[model samples]
Target: MSNTRPSLTLTLLQAREAAMAFFRPLLNQHGLTEQQWRIVRILRQQGELESHQLARQACILKPSMTGVLGRLERDGLVRRWKSPQDQRRVYVNLTEKGQQCFVSMSDGMESNYQKIQAQFGEEKLQQLLGLLNELKQVKP
Candidate 1:
């Protein structure tokens, strides 16, 4: 007989996947892909970042960012220009249109966040968030 331990970690992963599946489709309705929405959310928080930095924060590869940036640039949601000091490096910032989108997305995200809080009480959510953050800590 195989010894099987019940795992909260596995359950959490499944719940996260299900939640993302539901939330992501709502953003898609606004003509934004999951990756694009992530970029918008990150920019809303960080103000501005180098294109490479945005890619890192989004947990996407640099190559994938090239296309995402290209699409966002074409949509006029993001503006990218070479850094004044180093022309080789490009910086990305949200345009007014991008900010509007960010605001809407943030509202939706916050609503979903509240639902999560309601599903699991504040204290449990806080504990889960702390545990998740601890799991996400950078390793040297």
Candidate 2:
């Protein structure tokens, strides 16, 4: 039998889990799921975005995005409205509460990032990020 080792996909996922371990506690303290945090972060950085755009950026499926948005809206963290130009299109933005939440969590997030950088080395982290970005461009 041929020797079997961990596949690249499995290795990547393990690495992701390892990295998230450092930040998951902070996210939990803020009562945010990974997906919720991703949405909030993107909205904070990109301002208002269409529902589809938010989903695409967050790498969430359309159906799952609806539920996530519902929770955020219920929590008063986000507000959604239909576009005036195209009622079929929906836009989402952070509420004042959401902005506050992001600001409050920013420090903790930065601290966790620093811990990761210190443990993993900043140069290697940047190189890994660059490689991951390049990997995204790979076609099947």
Candidate 3:
């Protein structure tokens, strides 16, 4: 048998899963999927954005985004409206309920993050984040 290197893609996926494990329970408790949580988080930080921009920032495909947004809108956690300037474009923003939901979850999220930093070591986690950001810049 020969020594073989692990696949980078697999390693990254594993790391993501491991990291998400910490936050998954919190998200589940709030009845949110990862994609849904991502959109909520982005909207909270970015204010109103076009549907396309939200899809891009959330790394969600346009087709899937429609359903996700539909559900969010249906739940009254978010609101969407056709752009006044461009009927073809739609804008999305969190409703007051959505803001409350985020506020409710933030403390748990922050606690989990602090736990990760403590267990992983703040310096190591920072270094890992820096490396990951650098890797994201690499173009294939």
Models 1 onward score TM values of 0.84, 0.95, 0.94
Local accuracy of candidate 3 as per-residue lDDT tens digits, 1-140: 98899899999999999999999999999999999999999999999999999999999999999999999999999999997888999999999999999999999999999999999999999999999999989997
lDDT of 1 by residue, 113-132 (tens): 78877887999989988987
Candidate 1 Cα errors over 4 Å, as ranges = 1-13, 138-140
Better of 2 and 3 by TM-score: 2
Indicate the TM-score of model 3: 0.94
TM-score of 2: 0.95
Give the whole-model CA lDDT for all candidates, comma-separated. Answer: 0.87, 0.97, 0.97
